[model samples]
Target chain A: MTVTVRPVTAADEAQWRARWEKYNIFYKRTVPENVTANTWKRFLDDKVPSYAAVAVDDSKPDGDNIIGFVTFLPHMFTGSIEDQVYLGDLYVDDEARNGGAGRKLIEYVYDWARQHDIYSVYWHTQHFNHRAQLLYTKVADKTDFVQYGKMIKK
Target chain B: MTVTVRPVTAADEAQWRARWEKYNIFYKRTVPENVTANTWKRFLDDKVPSYAAVAVDDSKPDGDNIIGFVTFLPHMFTGSIEDQVYLGDLYVDDEARNGGAGRKLIEYVYDWARQHDIYSVYWHTQHFNHRAQLLYTKVADKTDFVQYGKMIKK
Candidate 1:
C-alpha cells in the first residue's frame, strides 16, 4: 500500500472525525462534540492559522483510505522572527503502523512550513509514547523541556 | 517590596526588552534584533492573539521596577471546546527571586485565561530548571509530556 500525504479537504470530514475520535481514545481522553466541531471549522477557515493534513493509502480505490492525520498551527515566537509551527495532534491508525505514514505526514508538515517560510516546528508527546518516539528520534531532536499545565477553568 | 501584575503597555517597551533579552539568555538562545522588535510589537498589538503581562515592584517610585513578565497566546485545541492558552515565555528577574514574583506571574496568567474564558494553560521548562520547577510544582501539575523539535529552517 502506497501512503501519500495531502492537505485535508471538506470531503474528508467524516473519515477525519472517525480517526480523531480514535486518536483521543488512544490517549484516554474525550473531546466534546462542540469542541470537535469548532476544531473542524478552524481547519477549513482560511483566516485561521490552524491546519490539518492526512495520509492516505493511494492503492485504495475509494478516497476514504485515510490512515492518519496531523494538526498544526503557526504562532509568533519570542526567539524567532518567523512563526513557529506547533504540531498539536498527530495519530496514525494502528493498522497503518510501520508503513512510513507517520514519517510522511511529518515531512509533509516540514514541506508546508518551508513553503510558508516558517522557522521551526515543535511538538510534545507523552513519555510513555515510546513507539512514536522512535520515529520522532529519527526526524527531530528530543528537547530537554518537560511540560507543565494548569486547568484554569477545568 | 509590593509586587503587582498588569498587561504590558507601550511605555513598558524598554524594560520589557531588557528582561526579554535576559529571558532568551536564560535558555541559551539568541534572537535576532528583528525578531525581538517584532515580538515586542506583538505584545502591544491588539489585533494579535499573543499577549504579555509584566510583574512590577509597585513600591518603587519609578515605573521601571518591572520584576518579570509572562507571554501567552490562546489557540484551538481538539480536546476542549474552549481555547487553550500556551504560556510561551515566562521569566522573573534574578534579583527578585524568592519573593513570590514567579508565582504571582503564573497566577496572573491564570487570571488572564479565566477572564478570556480559556479552559487550560500550559508551558514547558528545561529539566535543569529546578528553581523554577519548585514554584511551578506549587502552582501547576508537571505533565508526562516531553517536547521534541526540528529546525526545518535556520
Candidate 2:
C-alpha cells in the first residue's frame, strides 16, 4: 500500500541495472556492462563509500517493485570542515514519475547524510534536464558555482 | 635545481599551507584552519582516498622549497567500469608559475592514478581561470558535460 525507500541488496541488481540503463539513456549515454557490474558490486562493498537507495512498491514482489533509485558517495572538500555527500544519480521509472518516488529517494539520501554527520549533500544535472530541475528546485537550493572539468583518459 | 613532484609528507604542512592559502586567495576563497587541518590529515590517512602531491626544489631545504601542490581523490562514477581520480585542488605559487611546477604536480597525479588502475583523471576550474585552462588543454581533453550541484546545509 505504501512506497518504501531503503538500501539496495544484491538481489535487486537486475532491477537496479534496468533503472541505471534507463537513466543513462535519458542522458544519451550508455555504460558498458563491465562498468555497470562494477558499480553494482561497489554498492555492496563495505570498504567502498558507494551506495544505492531504492524506492519500491510494497504491493508488488521485491525486485519487480523497485521503481526508483539514487546513488551517493561521501567526499572531502577543502571548502568545508565536514564531509560532503555527493549524490551521483537519481532516477525513477517513467511509469513511477509522479508518484513521489523521486522525492522519497532524495529525502532518503538526506537522512543518510545526517546519520553520517555529512554537512552537505549535493549533485548536478544537465542544463537541459528542466523536468528534473523543476523537482530539484523544490527539494534543494540551486548552488552558485558552475562546475568545469576535463577528462584525462577513457 | 630541478622540480621534484611527490606525495606530501607531514613535514611539508607549513609550506603546503602557505601555497594553499595563496591558492585560495587567487580564487577569493578561504578555507578555515580546521578544514585545512582535516584535509591535511586525510592526505596522510591511508584509509581515506584524499591525497596531496607537491612540487618542490629538492636542492633547497625540504619544506621551504615547495612551490606547488595538487589534491586528488579516487571516486566511484556510475558510468565507469572503474573509479576515477577527481583532482580537486591544484595551485602553484605565483613566483613559481612558469617553472612548470603546476604541470609537474598534475603529472604526479597522473602517475598516482596509473598505479591505482584508475580509469580516468579529471578536474574543473573556474570559468575565468584561463591560466589553468591553458595548461589543462595541453594535458587533457575538454569534456562536454557541465556540472551543477546544490550545497545542502553547509
Candidate 3:
C-alpha cells in the first residue's frame, strides 16, 4: 500500500486526536482532554511557531485520512551556536507501521529544514522505543547528552 | 569572609554583568550585552513568572556585591503530575571559586523550592562541566535520561 504525507490541517483534528490518544496509551499514560485540545489548538496557532505533519494513505478513494503525525518547534542551540528544528513528537498508527511512513515524515522535516537553512533537527525518545530508534538510527547519530529532572518538594 | 545570599536587584546590575562576563568567558562564549540586560530586567519584571537568586559578600563592606546567581522558572510535570522548579542557569564568578558562593546559590534555591511546595528542582549541564556537576551532585540525584539532537540540513 502506498502512503502519502501532508501537513496537518484543522480538518484532520479528529483523526489526529484519535491517533494521538492511542500513541499516548502505548507509552502507558493518558493526557487529559483539555490538554489534548490545547495541543491541537496550539498546532493551528501560527503565533506559537509550532508545526505538525501527518501521513496518509492515498490508495483509498478519500485519500486524506491521517495515519501518523510528527510535531516540532524552532529552538536555539547554544552548543550548535545556531537555531535548529527540535522534533518533539512522532507517531504512526499500527496499521501504517513498518511501511516507511515514519521515515517519510522525517524526510519531510529534513526538506523543510534544508529550505530554511536550519543547522539540524534533534529529538529525544524513551529508551524503550526500540522501533522508533531503529528508524532514527538511519537518519542521525545518537549523542551522549542525557536528560535529567527532579521535582521541587513543596 | 562570610558571604550572604539574596535576590538580585537593579542596583546590582554592574557587578552582575562583570560576574556574568567572567562566567561566559569560562564557557568560551560571549552573550550579547542586550541579552544580559534583558535577563536582569526579567528579574524585576513582575509580569514575568521567573526569579533569580544572588550570592553576595557583605562582609567586604560593599553592601553585598553580586558573586553568583541562579535563575529558575516554575514548571508542571505531566507524567508525575507535580509542580517543580526548573533551574535554568547557575553561574558563580571564578574569583568566588571555592568560597561557598555557588553552594549558597543552590541552597537558596533549594529553600525557595521547599517554601513553595515544589516537588523538585532540576537542571542539566554538559558532561565536561565538572565543577558545576560537582555542585549538582551534592544536592540532587543524577538521572539517566539521555538527550539527543540532530541538525536539520538544508
Q: Which fraction of the native contacts appears in each prediction? A: 0.92, 0.45, 0.48
**How many clashes in candidate 3?**
20
lDDT of 2 by residue, A53-100 (tens): 999989898658999899999977766767788898999988878788
Chain A TM-score per candidate? 0.97, 0.95, 0.89
Which regions of candidate 3 fall more than 4 Å away from where they truly are?
A1-4, A61-64, A75-85, A95-98, A107-121, A127-130, A152-154, B1-14, B17-53, B61-64, B71-86, B94-122, B127-143, B151-154
Candidate 2 per-residue lDDT over residues B1-154, each given as its tens digit: 5899988898988999888888888878768888888889988898987889889887788547888899998877777866778888998878777888888888888888877878788776665677877888788766544455545555
Interface RMSD of each: 1.1, 2.8, 5.0
Q: What DockQ would you assign to candidate 2?
A: 0.41
- In CAPRI terms, where does candidate 2 land? acceptable
Chain B of candidate 3 achieves a TM-score of 0.86
Lowest lDDT sum, 10 consecutive residues, model 3 chain A, at A74-83
Docking class of 3: acceptable
DockQ of each: 0.83, 0.41, 0.33
Candidate 3 on A90-154: residue-level lDDT in tens?
88988788999998998888888877778788777776667878888898777765455554542
- What TM-score does model 1 score on chain A? 0.97
Q: Output DockQ, candidate 1.
A: 0.83
Write the residue-wise lDDT of candidate 1 on A18-132 in tens digits: 9999998888887889889989998998998889999999988656699999999887776777888999889899999999999999999999999988989999999998999
